[model samples]
Target: MAPHTRYTRLAEEALSPAHSVIATSQTYDGAAPFPDFPDDDRPAPARSGGERLQVAVTALIVTLPFLALGLAAWLLWGTLIRPTDALLALALYVITGLGVTVGFHRGLTHGGYRAGRPVRIVLAVAGSMSFQGDVIGWVATHRRHHAFTDRPGDPHSPYRYGTHLRGQLRGLAHSHVGWLFRNDPTPVERYAPDLLADRDIRAVSRAFPALCVLTLALPFALGWAIGGTWLHATTALLWAGLVRIALLHHVTWSVNSLCHVVGRRPFRTRRHDRATNLWPLALLSFGESWHNLHHAEPTSARHGVDRGQIDPSAAVIRLLERLGLVRDVRWPSPDRIATHRT
Candidate 1:
């Protein structure tokens, strides 16, 4: 059978009622039970001290880069942004963004391809620098997302509030960033057991904090080296380190929020899975906005399967395949693509 068909069958088996019950029963990091909003539109209950702390940290992570955007703007008004700063921001954005798309999401979460031990570890480390989350947790949460999709068990779904206008507005916020504040945790054991079993991946997951620091420090050091000044270093830190992160964060979150609510769905997915192909976000999101097809064939390495749809992540995977860095890629066949079409 084709890889897409095989993966679809496997995913269905994995998300069977028995497995769903077991997954929902377990908790990761001692998180509290996930709230059931239904269509009532009631406010979420109060959080505990630990949950409050988590929320504060998540808020800082979500907001600080946005604040940097304002600061960068102010700086730009007063002083022109250096070409080096712009270049550094672009470089780091592409690196960290591709790491998440290719490494964390496709390779680790969906088994899109297989790479050598060194390649796997490097990719994991690179993805960790994106500041989304630890590799294990990221993979686990995404796997759970695919399993439950837009249903009650989904960790982040824009349809959580129902199909009403008020609910959609609220649900969009919740799915985009508010879900980070919730205490709901996806169990790594249930969702990403293979990553947990891999010693290299475990190591990379554990080093997430250090990688976060490195991500920022590298830009600052490079800016200082290239421009030979503290001003250059500070500006690069703001633009490349913080602003770049903020942009990538919102772009990634848009796939969870706007893509579901807007855009075209050329492919059929599971019931309630309203993932869409958003053209505007294609370049920024590295083709992840071609989400409808992704949901249709969750394990397909290439998401932008149609004509004139640019998929940089798929291009990178093909490059890696040619370089012999990765193998067993699950590229979708034309027949498979046609089969999933609506």
Candidate 2:
């Protein structure tokens, strides 16, 4: 099947009432049996050398950026931050952040809008630079999250351990970053078959490792060229490359942890779907902290539908639409928003 056709089919399936039934039926408490997937049905495979290497690599990827904080602080203690490094960090953060919010989450995962081939590819590439994971895997895991929400099948729900205080604390850690270390994997074929069928998307997903290298290398190269010093290059790699990535990482994870556990639920969602509108994280998360409305209407392009809510991702989508780069945007109307309101 054609990529666009598959996308349309998946979008329809996601929005269909039947899909809601499937989601609701899958809901369970912690004691429920493991989800019925091929991976879970079979005996677990022994860890291979490659698997160990992957875990090590994942640890490095997750912690290296965070370690850069200490290095950055040391650098700051010695001298004032270079203007170029700060500016470069800000620019890359915005670009890569929007790439995730608009590209991976809104467009590819939910079909909030349809972009041309080039635009879609560019967005995928940009999002890949954020070091979140390959585009296909990211979409798959997120789709699964939506399918089960805070229930048992969710990949990273803070309520996974139950509603008790200690369980919530443990679940918060699990939802925030601990889940990345788990052996469980979301099946791309089941959750993101549309993306898997797209040649361009597959190409971008394959290029993820290269994009990860480039994301760091670009800052170093630019800093050297701009400042003509190795010191400048080092700082830029630290600030723009690692520190910026770390910041975005935590902010994105906060939407998973904090947004679900604590925040105003002004919009009604599925049973046990405790997504909330976290205003404090609105700007940092590119408006994704408006989780209540998003869960209420998954395909809506504008997450922050109410007044005074700053949705930079939605603004970027609107700009792309006006520039003729994207079409068929699913902007929610007032009536639609009202229907979801508490």
Residue 64 accuracy (lDDT) in model 1: 91
What are the per-residue Cα lDDT tens digits for candidate 1 across 1-342? 643334334444444334655343333121232337422325555788987886787788899998999998888886788888899999999999999999888787787887888887888888899889899998878877887677767889887767677888888999999888776767788776667767888999999989989999999999899989998899889999999999999999999899888999999987667899999999999999999999998888999999999999999999999999988989999998999888
Name the weakest run of 10 consecutive residues (lDDT summed) in model 2: 31-40
Best by TM-score: 2
Error of 2 at 164 (Å): 0.6
Show pairs that collide, candidate 2. Answer: none
Q: What Cα-based lDDT does every candidate model obtain?
A: 0.82, 0.86
Cα lDDT over the full model 2: 0.86
lDDT of 2 by residue, 1-342 (tens): 645456656754654334433342344644333343322345456678987887889899999999999888887895888899999999999999999999999999888888999999999999999999999999988887887777756779887667788778888999999888777777788778888878999999999999999999999999999989998899899999999999999999999999998989998998878998999999999999999999999988999999999999999999999999999889999998998888
Which residue pairs clash in candidate 1? none
